[model samples]
Target chain A: MATSAKSTDISKTDFGKSPINARLSAEQKLKLLTDMVRIRCFENESVRQYSAGKMGGFLHVYNGQEAIATGCASLMGDDDHMITAYRNHGHALGVGMNMNECMAELFGKATGCSKGKGGSMHFFAPDKNYWGGHGIVGGQTPLGLGLAYALKYKGVKGAAMCFMGDGAVNQGCLYESLNMASLFNLPVIYIIENNGYSMGTSLERSSAFKSCLAERAAGFNMEWAQCAGTDIYEVRASVQVAMERAHNESRPTMLEIDTYRYYGHSTADAKHNVVGGYREREEIDFYKKNHDPINVFKAKLIAEGVLTEEQFDTLEEGIKAEAAQSAVFADESPYPEVSSITEDVYYEVDRQTEAGRTGKHFFND
Target chain B: MALIEYRDALNQAFDEELARDENVVLMGEEVAQYDGAYKVTKGLWKKWGDKRVMDTPISEAAFIGMGIGASMLGIRPVMELMFWSFATVAWDQIINNAAQVRYMSGGLINCPIVIRGPANGGTNVGATHSHTHENFLANVPGLKVVCPATAYDAKGLMKTAIRDNDPVMFMENTLLYGEKWEVPEEEYLIPLGKADVKREGTDITLIAHGRAALTALRAAEILAAEHNISAEVIDLRSIRPLDEEAILASVRKTHRAVLIEENKPFCGVGAQISSILMEKCFDDLDAPVLRISSIDAPAIYSPELERKQLPRPLDIVAKVLSIC
Candidate 1:
């Protein structure tokens, strides 16, 4: 297990000072960078569209947490299942959800992932093994554990990664889930995205132990670790190591990723309201200009002479165009008809068996 | 056919289902190693092993949510809540997540899970464990609530619930667990949304469920012997997707109807029955539809208070006698 001292040192080190650079090929790095940029651009556009009243209902953007979803999902195979809380547009995009389908869903069009019934919070694509973007606070934790239990029962080699915010740590269901998962040694990774706050309440005020989410895992007798969520390499390494332990020992692990969200809890909250506006414009500018995950990867690629600045710009332009096209498709698509409202509530069928063959045919007079 | 107690019948249902489907699992506080709290799951962990028959921590919400997830992945899970009253702790998962998945997901997912537990009064388990909250689950859609009063119904209905593709809330009676009744030796399934006429008569239709149905039957026998008033008794096997047609038909035939429920009169199953009768069989009524229910008081540990709180056979008889 990685020690707290080493993890702390890793967090303090600058992005370029780390020995571990993303080992992806030039093409893969460019593709991943493009994916991350697409998510950011798409969400920014979504925010603009929401303000213009083009989109309706709760619109949760994945502006700041793109690296966590992209990095973790990139490491996962197609068969692995992913379940998370409502802040899920990034995970959906990372798992290969179509930009058009997702955008259309935001527009409440029939072509959305949930066919317009489940807007931003409840996107589901079973074909991709993306279980859901559950709206309930910590409701998905036990469900993710169950999915992993099912996989083990079926003798399959897949793990379930359950994501929740720092606020959801207080939920009793999560604690019980942790105990059960550890007891059964289920192949599950409980990822706590400790983005400093839960909604608007800071963790320091709410949580008794804010800095060490991993120590709590010891109460359940499970392995644990903490890593810098902003650093892609650290996030990837932590996930990879924890996932290995889970898969090999068939045990659950807790990974607390200390990250930050640039936007408010939801699209509705103002960024300047919380923590006495502790986050200065300089800090936001520093992170965006220097430590932005996409930009960091882009500079690495440029330093390696794998891709030029012009090529990277062209890729960004292409993704923006695709996102815009998706928006248009969603705009034109029709809302689900009313008749489908009662469908799929339950799986039931009426069957007929041959009991009596003797029949009398009577002609109507 | 063999005779078995209601509790043994439920055990048999779990045993048979687990043996038939490898994906079927059972979990609760003491369901596995300690045997079930009522011994309904006794000897299950020995036969199915720990993986299939798990004894979970006393976290109702977590285990129930796990059951929901397992069911979504084609594993038919039967979760025991120890007592139905503890369902309040897991209400968020049961009411919000499990019940809403299929509908909210646009039918993409189905919660094929069953929550089994002992419900209703008469056990002296005190106010906490004795209250009958089957009506609470009955109000939720995308869930089938069944309360079987007989061993035959328990076996058949439990089997049906395990095979069902939607979530089912199976309510058992603590007092009736030891009561024996005849059950079929071969495989059988009683489909949901079907009501059974336990006793047929023409004067009045006594609609009841769970333990109240047995009380209604007892009252029918007494009424026949004493006043010669024939009462038709219907056991509403499944509460949701209620057999409104059969109920309306019975009310139309009898003209006078008496609804008996273990729950309070307000917003109980009896209320829905009364509403349907008023709408469909109002003109056919010989008198106003009478309801026999528990008083609007919480169940008490005291025997006298509990007796006053619950619907008694005498209460049914008096209501029937008045209507007839």
Candidate 2:
């Protein structure tokens, strides 16, 4: 069942020497590493709890592609926004959402980010400009276009970061979004996290393209760039350029970040029957050895004398403990009351307006 | 009070709401510069300019989805669809994204956007162009559907829909766009989910919404004059937050009931009304609840046949007579 993973040397530049990395304070650089570690620790714990039957529905863990979300979110201004598909735990954590609330959401407790209504796939934090963890494939593309449209409407010099997987590139709505993003000159970046395989379909099988996925951006006459997601510095540099275009010129950009996922598309693909049958273990090991985002960044930080080995271990341990405590918080939190089931369907009902008082809004009620 | 065309009433509502709320914006194909395909958005573009009143590409899914995204951040986007039949292309945005955003986010977000356009038949636009999806939209628990039969209700209901915190699917009729009725110059808001009794009667209850409500009113007059049957006509302006109380109150007094709608017979709005009557007003009913709807088929393309396809005044009269 082993399908050979192709070895493509994407980017081998030493980010320790890059100006973008040098510009960032040592504390800020450590914060980025700490954020990536926090996400990984949380995702690993989610998979553990999910396997142990603590979570329901599909659990789409963002294990390996942590640097893309971490890098892109760092460049976001207060007016900027972020939205992503169901593989959203990484982005939600990167945007500084409470780990306990996010974990409680996965556990379907009242304290969850979405109040147990939107399990893992619908995290939302509008106060922090994290729009959602939308469920549908390619559906979030247009919604992302909208976030940018609204920003422009309000005359904010900010952009919206809309992240999707490689497989989502083929959806018709993405093309529709691309056309409008260019026509209106909205400040939105469409980041495609190309992880070699989508669910079970490899990039070679799922998409038809001339050279790369971002090349399709040429059809709309928008700017595009490709980068390796293993190095956070490279991710920041490539995304900073897109952010500048969005802020200064009010233009959209398509970014293709080459990454890999160690887990299956979701926890349900456990047998690896879907993914393992398509991709080999050697391929997975190759990425883990050569291009693990956390390891790659940690080594660069140490080589630059930003942190000692002891400091790195202590930081990782603290994040791991924080991720573990989130599970305990989720376990202790209560489920929503039965009477609360009918609430939140409408805003008027929640606000108890004059309109909400009269009608038989709920048929069962 | 001033008599205004249905289209003008909607225009006045848009103008007033746009002026009232700076957060409110209008976007859709041909909405700006072109003054709207149906002219429901006429003159707004010249007033609000590019930022507030804008035109979008012919892509329904993208624009509609964009409206939803904008609404989540407190932008009240009153999106026009040119024709409600075109909403099928953006069905995911309407049904899943718009309707379910607030509920799925557990009330963390509110999509207070109004998607307005024509949804009707009898103009011989064929099956594709002629679609009435009020029943489909109302079926979803999170969505609110309203169909205003009169110019007064069009303006009142539309203004309220724009202010409401949930997604509202405002269904309009091309055939009734030019029809004139009294709408006051003063600002007013018609609370949704409240039905208006177009006529009072003692024998039978006739219920309908949108353009079909007018048809039911005509049938009520026919039944009163010709057949000597007093039929109370109930116009259920809001479909989702249904006015079951009004329906029950009218049916209890009349002792017989007849539901009517422009949608197909199977699982139409009329079907829902009949079910409500059966469950809530069974003891008061003197006969089985009957329904008169557009013939159970796709909308006909032929002009002559299309008229026959939709429920006429005589059709409602016949159904009332059968039940009474």
Highest lDDT, which number?
2
What's model 1's lDDT at B248? 84
True-structure Cα RMSD, model 1 = 4.9
Query: Per-residue error at A179 for model 2, in Å?
Result: 0.9
> Which segments of model 2 are wrong by more than 4 Å?
A1-12, A16-19, A271-276
Please provide TM-scores computed only on chain A for all of the candidate models, following their numbering.
Answer: 0.87, 0.96
* lDDT per residue as tens, model 1, A159-248: 889999888989999999999999888999999987767776666666776348666898889998877766666677778877777667
lDDT of 1 at A180: 90
lDDT by residue (tens digit), candidate 1, B167-189: 98999988899999998888888
**Fraction of true contacts kept, per model?**
0.49, 0.72
Candidate 1 falls in which docking quality class? acceptable
TM-score per candidate, in order? 0.93, 0.97
lDDT of 2 by residue, A53-127 (tens): 999999998888999989988888898899999999999999999799999999999999989999999999988
**Candidate 2 on B1-324: residue-level lDDT in tens?**
788999999999999998899989999999999999988888989988998899999999999999998888789999999889999999988888998888778888889999999999888989999999998999898899999999999999999999998899999999999999999877999989999999999999889999999999999999989999998999999997999999999989988988889999888988887888888888998999988888888898989899999999998888777767
Worst 10 residues of 2 chain B by lDDT: B315-324
Name the candidate that leads on TM-score.
2
